[model samples]
Target: MTATDPAMTALAHSWSALSLLHGRIEGSVERALQTEHRLSAREYSLLDVLSRQHDGEGGHLQMRQVADSVVLSQSATTRLVTRLEDRGLLSRYLCPTDRRGIYTDVTDDGLRLLEEARPTHNTALRKALDQAATEPVLAPLVRAVHQLQGDIPRPDDRP
Candidate 1:
């Protein structure tokens, strides 16, 4: 109730502002991924990982690994891969050495989608980073966040 109280003087806006910003990011990425590539955020994330696959002789990351990386259950991962395979956007090749194992490969169609998504994705990311880069007060917080690898999802096309 004091006239000089910091709570009254200073803005109480961060939580709302940050939430709005995050919502915009989620909406923007969702729109771009779906309209431009006919992909959901999760499906686009899966393709993004596979696009990082090297040597095109077909790179296969274990389904379980991908699921854990993206915070999805094994069954969900299986279903996601199944959907992509149905669309000819992905393929599952048996791991030659492990009969019980399989890996997902991004198909040519998946690569095409990635090509469509890359520039838009990069521009969004760079714009966000550019804002972060300007905040000297946030530098330590950003570094601390970067150091946190405790099962956190990497910033991808996923929400």
Candidate 2:
């Protein structure tokens, strides 16, 4: 169908609505984390992932793997890792077997900071979602968004 077609118009509106919701929720969470914990949303996300890895074992993921998991570009992830390293939140090391590859792991300080920020981040997100759900016009979209998240597999759930 053409861009101006009714079906296309409806699809565009749907995408726009989803994008707006994402921005709103993300902004709220980011502000809360940054204000209370001095951590950006992306930084908190990376720390959370590394904390999980730390719990599972001492194994660390390569830089590229971290970039993919956190939906960041390689260059951006590299910069972020450098920032976190400077803050004593994480460390990077060359792979023992493959010298070309670099692995990243969360430090004790990173885990502690993540633990401090998690509650703030989660509460902000939940409040935003709950507010949206209370609005009759947005309730269906909110429910759909929640369901979509549930449908996506977590790392451990993947085969």
Candidate 3:
């Protein structure tokens, strides 16, 4: 297809449109979570990942992996982990095989908080999904966005 084709134009416009939509939805979720639970989106994201990560010992996410997943620099991830650790929400352990690598594990307190906040987070997500359902095009759009993410280079890796 030619560059001037309508499909190509639509695809270009879709990129920007989806970006705006994604940011707005994420912002809404962040605000509500911070207001009610005192958790930043980044912290929530880290916890979410750690809660699901498999470490052969327990749930934990390597600091670098979490940093990459959340698009935070290593220093930023370290600071975030420090704050959470101070709050008794997370702990970091040096990897046995790699002394320099740190793995952040959610504390039991963190797990408790996560369990407690599930309702709140679910509510916000449900509200977003409900809003999207009003348009009927949103769920499929979200799936397409996930697909697109696979093709897009990560931000930190991009020039």
User: What is the lDDT of every predicted structure here?
Assistant: 0.68, 0.83, 0.74
Q: Give the TM-score of candidate 2.
A: 0.85
TM-score of 1: 0.62
lDDT of 2 by residue, 1-159 (tens): 676999888888878877777888889999999999999999999998777764244467767778998889989999998999999999887877779977788888998999989888878888788787887656788899779766333325556
lDDT of 1 by residue, 13-34 (tens): 4444445455555566667667
Summarize candidate 3's per-residue lDDT along 1-159 as a digit string, tens digits.
Answer: 898999989888777667756776787778878998998778887777777776677455666778898889989988988998999998887888879877777889999888776667766755664565456446566556547645333324556
Worst 10 residues of 1 by lDDT: 137-146
TM-score-wise, the better of 1 and 3 is 3
User: Number of the top candidate by lDDT?
Assistant: 2
Top-scoring candidate (TM-score): 2
Ranking by lDDT: 2, 3, 1
Candidate 2: worst-modelled 10 consecutive residues by lDDT: 149-158
User: Model 1 misses residue 127 by how many Å?
Assistant: 5.7
Q: Candidate 2's C-alpha lDDT?
A: 0.83
- TM per model? 0.62, 0.85, 0.74
Candidate 3 achieves a global lDDT of 0.74
What clash count goes with each model?
0, 0, 0
